[model samples]
Target: MSNRSTRARIGRRVMVHTPVGGSRSVMMGAVAAVTLATLVTGCGGKSQDHPSSSAAGNPAIGKLPQATTFANLKNVAKDSGADAAGNGTVAHPTAAVPVSATPGGPPVATLPDKELGGPTWVPVVETKPGWQRVLLPSRPNGATGWIPAGKMHTAHSPYVVKVDTSARRLSLLKSGQSLGTWTVAVGAPKTPTPAGRTFIMASLAPAKATYSPLILPVGAHSESLDTFGGGPGTVAFHGWPQKSVFGQAVTHGCIRVPADALQQLAKVPLGTPVSISN
Candidate 1:
């Protein structure tokens, strides 16, 4: 994990991801508009703090299978109800693994060994004999990349989350049963949040964000904003202290939640499904 500045450019504030896991809100709309576009979205300090490892290039492929839509990086066989199918098992990575552009293509980015700390890689979807396609934690949302299967270890999870932009709410479920629900802030009409089947790529605690203690960077991005907070407009599940923002269209593209709601969401494993809809 390199200590690179992961800041983003909001309307006028320069939301910086500090090397110490702290967030610095500097006003740089005029000073560094170009620089802000280069910052990553959430958990600024190191790329390792989040599961969406940095890769240079467009990761958009096409529509994937229904089940393969989200990142299966932490779903184990037993948890995925895979005792029967045995085909859609998610494999966790034992060591740092290199992501490929194609089934057996060149290296795009190297995934750190740690899975945002606890829940690591559970790569399913075998593409070829030696290669497997896993969901990437990148912008333009729902991106997938290939990696060597032999380099990964496997797992599963039974939890899932559903976010409804129309209703401005989020629901958590386990084995299809509701655990909890909460109001949330979505993107403004001009900067709509990218929807579809995504997953929790990482759980991060910003060193200095006044809103909440944690942030969950999802495998989605902003459809309108190209580069936000210096990153690739990557959408995330984060907290906002402002109560008024709840149940409203106020964010650049990220989903904003109350602090209490964010605590519960942090418990969910990385790579768990995060289905967002309009």
Candidate 2:
């Protein structure tokens, strides 16, 4: 995430199943140039006290923990049941999880129909028992499954996110679609926040991190973002300096909110759909 988020990398998780239905394994993959790629895009920031100069102006700043690097550790159900293609090693760290194509590959029964765009490298969301699962490439395709959940990660998670840098606030959206909004800190005058329609690709619990909207990637730890850049520094939502300046037009490009706001955003799921406009 630190440097690869801006590259031509694709990420997805290996799938596993369980009694609870279906789930995905921990995410793994290499997204070179993923998180900070759009840092140069011309997205704007928000502040009731001061607005951005870009098209996507004045996003609200919300509450977020004072973090420079954070992760949302997602547990997989364990892979006691993955198709057993052989021993597969996880890939380099990035926002997306990576599963090396097995040597012999999975069992024929476990493979998805190639025509249906079945089973390929995908970012794992949750894992289950006796099955490996992944996001279906297409609609009606839903999710692909394989492997058992016992050896992968864990099962299920409880957390959601909502970001409003223009208002300088983030909302914690629960499973019920409700949320708790708070303030946050974003990019600074040099490392301003980026703007675009983005979502949480991966997450990990926070450590001694200081950046808001912390993400969970592989090695260096970077969040997966699929936002369309508007211009140089055009993307929205990114980490910034945690300072006394919350409501002010201060950043190189991206919006700068507070710490609590980024923490709330860290909970959102990958591809969670965002619509940022002035």
Give me the candidate number with maximum lDDT: 1
Candidate 1 per-residue lDDT, tens place, 1-278, comes to 21113333234444444222333445555336535523543333323324344222433311111111123222211122222112334566655566666766656455545544554544354457888766555443555667786777766666777899989999988766888899998877766777776677777776766456787877666666444454545678887756877898867778888777788788877767677889
Deviation of model 1 at 44, angstroms: 7.5
> Which lDDT values do the candidates have, in the order given?
0.59, 0.30
Cα deviation at 226, candidate 1, in Å, is 2.4
Count of residue pairs whose backbone atoms collide, per candidate: 25, 140
What TM-score against the true fold does each predicted structure earn?
0.66, 0.31
lDDT of 1: 0.59
List ranges where model 2 is wrong by over 4 Å: 1-160, 185-196, 204-241, 252-257, 262-271
**What tens digits encode model 2's per-residue C-alpha lDDT throughout 224-263?**
2222221111233545554555554454323444555555
Error of 1 at 254 (Å): 0.9
Give candidate 1's TM-score: 0.66
